[model samples]
Target chain A: MSECIVITSGKGGVGKTTTTANLGVALAQQGHTVAVVDADIGLRNLDVILGLENRIVYDLVHVIEGECRLKQGLIKDKRLDGLSLLPAAQTRDKNAVTPDQMRKLVAELKEHFDYVLVDCPAGIEQGFKNAVAGADKAIIVTTPEVSAIRDADRIIGMVEAAELPEPQLIINRFRAKMVQSGDMMNKEDILEILAIPLLGVVPDHEDIIVSANRGVPVAFDDESLVGEAYRRIGRRLGGEPDVPLLDLTVDDGLWTTIKRWMGLAPAREVAR
Target chain B: MSNPAPARVGGGAPVVVRTLSAQSGADGVIVSVRVDVAFDDVRAELHRVLGQTPERWRNRMARLDLGDRDVELFDVRRLVHLLKGDYGLSVTAVYTTERAVHRYVSRELKLQVFTRDPADDCVQALVGAVGEAGATAVTEVGPHAIDSDGVTEIVSGPAVTVEDTTSFETDDDVVEDDGAIADLSYDDESGAAKAAPEPEPDVVLPVEPMPIRIAGGQRVQSIPRSLRGGQSVRFPGDVVVYGDVNPGAVVEAGGNILVFGALRGLAHAGSHGDEAAVIMAFDLRPTQLRIGGRIAFQGLEDDIPRGPGFRPEIAFVTDERIRIEPWRGRLPTEQVATGDAPPSTKTPGDAAEAAPVTEQ
Candidate 1:
């Protein structure tokens, strides 16, 4: 039986779409047929990240309306054989599909696929309801910032109310260096507040931005730290054993040398 | 589809199989097949078809008998396929058997046999049985009853009287023809109309209103500027510093105050205020101190420490007496450079330095 999972976060710009795209690619690489559904509707970006924007002739809305068959609307990934995408319509609003219709569509898709991953929209609204209506499980993405954690807590409450199964948390854009320096909140602090199982952490990396711009998920790039992290997340979801977190500690000598060479380091302010 | 040839025996009287086919165009087909045979042989045949002996077949078949056994087999898969495959016959039917005949036909042979019984129609028979037992057998409701009749009845009497005496008022006035009153009158046998007289006007004597007292304390009006005395004046709450209190002004506050620059004002610690309330200044040169209800004047004998130019200082009641202290302490830069301080406390100093400072 197929398991539908929704990747969501209450706050925007927390890498929900990026996580969705990367996880889809990673799961597909494992030979599981995966379909990534972008439920952001009018503000669709999953297609762009997957680099399949130009190929989207018929979208989710069209398929739901019987204007096109599901097979016709599904965009097969050029890079990954087992991964496909059902892009949201940019012209239509979120109201175009109801939760019941989404449930029906997902039920129909469950017969043919092993995993259906949905990219949920920001905020706990109708779009969120529609995205999670058919999902068997959920993945909540959050940053270590106070506002992001607070919003994630609210989203967790909402998901609980919807009667969905427990949601695992993926801390995104975590700067381990800052966290070590006490400048940012740590993983334990976020998890303690959210009270959810930690899936895997995706460190902040420039390669992610580059890959996203190129419409290729970083998971395909084995050399990238974030790409490896995404792959580990996929494995964990596949019921694999625990994987260690990425060591983000930079060498003190290297950090100091770089700072000294750039003259960007500030002298400690003295007060009496 | 054609029906299979009947099983035959040459010794006994020729058994004629009469097949009655009724094609109710819209309603559906009802075909009946009658066969005459011995009772013992028919029982064995039923056992073979149902895949169980008599005891095991009880749940499968509702009614059974030795001779003239009327088995209402509804849409039997093996029998229907036989009828369609061998004999080109498409019909629904009920079968009635007065006797049993199990003359074995070849394994390859197929027969289309219809039994005239309610059980011949799968859905119809099941529905009919459930209906006969007066049970609502809906697909969705299953065995669970959809509607229940056990309802709770609330025994209600006259409502409890809750008199709102606070809002009640009595009025006395000359009787006037106004429709304001409710019509509580009932018809008399004589058809004569009668009405109750209006109530007398009530006189409400005015009572003295209670004095309004502030919850915390009375607001202290602004102190007169001309009433300047070096004697420390303590307040119960905030002291509003309107003008510059000179170094010898010796003003004290119970809480906090806003001083508009040049706090050369010798504000004493704690006026009528709590002892913990402090005296702050852009420049700290207080001549006297007082906290709560206590007053302490600066003596000539007390030695004061010279600062590396005191920027701002706040003096509060410490050790049960006012003590002046400088506000400077270890800064963020010093902490970061030393690395001895907790790393978490070391945020970029620029962000910390940008924090707004308010004097009150």
Candidate 2:
């Protein structure tokens, strides 16, 4: 049966949309029909990230408002065969979609797809409610930073308040080298604060930025470390065994070490 | 101007002293005497007015010139005293050494002089002259003290004594002795309206009549309202409902809940925060349920189960995970009954409970 999963993080800029795009791509690549619905209405960016902005013939608001059929609004992604998107309307506000309407839409999608991943907006406002309304489960994405973890904890409380199924945690953009150097908070510390089951850790990587800028999700790039991380997160969503996080630290050679000591050349940046 | 006034009485003298008769000013009496004396005499007069010894005065006087005249004065203390005395009169001293004469005059003086006989009559006449709006001037003759009693009588209102006129009544007149303003009437035949039954002294009925033991050596502290048959139920501990619980019903217990029935109404388990608390219904349907935080229907779904033992259930989360589980046929009863239900217990059953009929 298809499962409606909402990827939500209470704090903004915590990789919620990125996770939704990558997970949907990863799920679709595994031969499962997947639909990524962007719940952030007026501030729509999911279509841009998926590089399907120009292909949008109808939006979610038009479908919900009865101006367009649900099938008319479903944009099939050319990158992946089974992957489709229900882009949020940039012209309309969040009030254009009701939780009941979202529930009905997700229910309809559940019949055809193996996964319906909703990209919830930041904050615990109406957008969040609309996104989480029809979800069978949730994936809370958070960074290792204190504020992000705190917000994730608040989101966990909210998800629990909604009485949805238990949510899994995906710690995104973790800096392993910084964690080793004691400069960054570790995954264990994040889990201690959030107190939710850990699904996977996504390392910080420049390729993720490159892929995001090019409107291609990192999960599609098998060679990229962050891309592999996104694939592991997708496998985890499919109830696969836990995959170890990537080691992002750069090895120091003698010349590199000497340059580091001389403060001439910078130390290697961590990879995702 | 006729004959140059035959050189006025104290004119052209370095020191001029004028003593006018008492009937000169507007009050018909000159209470102040102006004297234009030498600097030394002026200093002596100042010392006298201030009741200070002449030795206390400084010899070197400060010279002050008014227009073209120079006057030497020791201090301004004497002028201050004259202004504050009878009739509130003031004086200005002028010493014209260049002109060879000093002129001194009372700046503004109006005094009422007193006579020994018919002194009260003069006082009365002064009072009448001042009336309510004009200035009232009264002078007493000799060393006699002024009668303050008459002034006090005219200014003050008459005094009267107040007594506590409130009367007391016997208890019989006031029925229902609580003293509240409720209608208090004593009908001899109708037994003195009982004191509204002293609020039935906080009867602490045992909330938990019987406790049921669950797993982990934790006992269900209160009996489940479902088993209690529809009685206004309150459990001292946790209540476990085993059947379809009804609405307009209450289930309060001290421990936790494991309902095999569809929980329809208010279900409060661990009314206190026994972090080990939980609430699990087979159908998992309820109007409102509270383990701790107030929970209302976030949304209602029609696909919920209706009958008993159709779906297994368990709920428990303390500072960590809040979970619900469906009873699989293979799982032990104690596993579902205890607070330590497995995380994987939530399963979708084919025989889903019918939609809970919620009372509007």
lDDT tens per residue, model 2, A1-272: 88999999989998999999999999898889999999999998899889898899899888888888888999999878999999999998888888999999899989888999999999988999999999999999999886786577667767876899768898888776677667888776666445568878787777778888889998999887677777877876786765554444433244446666798645444322
How much DockQ does model 1 earn? 0.01
- TM-score per candidate, chains pooled: 0.43, 0.43
lDDT by residue for model 2 over B102-214, one digit each (tens)? 11111111111121111112222222332332332222111010121111101100110001101111122111222221111111212243321211111211122112223
What are the per-model DockQ values?
Answer: 0.01, 0.01
lDDT of 1 by residue, B65-180 (tens): 11124321221333444334433333233233211111000011122222223223222332232333332121110001101110100000111011100111111110021111
Off by over 4 Å in 2: A242-245, A248-272, B1-360
**In model 2 chain B, where is the ten-residue run with the lowest total lDDT?**
B351-360
lDDT of 2 at A235: 77
Off by over 4 Å in 1: A250-272, B1-360
Local distance difference test scores for all models: 0.54, 0.54
The TM-score of candidate 2's chain A against the true chain A comes to 0.90
